[model samples]
Target: MGDKANCNCHTGNAVYGLGLIGAAIYFISQATSFIMGVLGFVKALFWPAFLVYEAFSYFAV
Candidate 1:
């Protein structure tokens, strides 16, 4: 039972870490777009990639 509790705690931490990583990626992408202006077209590519990544990550978790 104690081991199960520990495993649950670790899973929670992993989830929290994933959320933070996703948020950081989103903010960084937005910042890059703002800074690059029209050149942000390249950054636009990242949104789809990010979405795919998020979907995979969520399902994998």
Candidate 2:
């Protein structure tokens, strides 16, 4: 009953955790240099923000 209310919180965390891992793998794989790999790791941490920004730019005039 009351416990079910907290389930949604965990679900969001799981989704974000998975997304972060996937993004890290993708960005790091594409990186050719060690510095680029480090940059990719940082970029992976903010992938969602970059996504939203691109989405807004694409949809905006």
Candidate 3:
């Protein structure tokens, strides 16, 4: 029973991460590549940069 909860936590985290990536790709598509979907998806592979920027910007203030 305890193990099941732990497993679900990890699974949920993985799903959340994937969802963020998908969202980033969608936003990029809307901004730059609505015509060529793959370009935005390729760009979204660097989603970590946005996350890092947000973290630094938040703390810098």
Question: Which structure among the candidates has the greatest TM-score?
Answer: 2
The full ranking of all candidates by TM-score, starting with the best, is: 2, 3, 1
lDDT tens string, model 1, 1-61?
Answer: 7777665347766765676566556566666555554345444435556678899999995
What is the clash tally of candidate 2? 0
Distance from true location, Cα of 33 in model 1, Å: 8.7
lDDT of each: 0.60, 0.92, 0.70
Please report how far candidate 3 places residue 39 from its true position, in Å.
3.3
Candidate 2, residues 1-61, lDDT tens digits: the string is 7898666557777888899999999999999999999999999999989999999999993
Q: Is candidate 2 or candidate 3 better by lDDT?
A: 2
Clash statistics: count for each candidate: 0, 0, 0
Q: Worst ten-residue run, lDDT, model 1? A: 37-46
TM-score against truth, every candidate: 0.38, 0.82, 0.42
Rank by lDDT, highest first.
2, 3, 1
Write down the RMSD of all candidates, one decimal each. Answer: 8.7, 2.1, 4.4
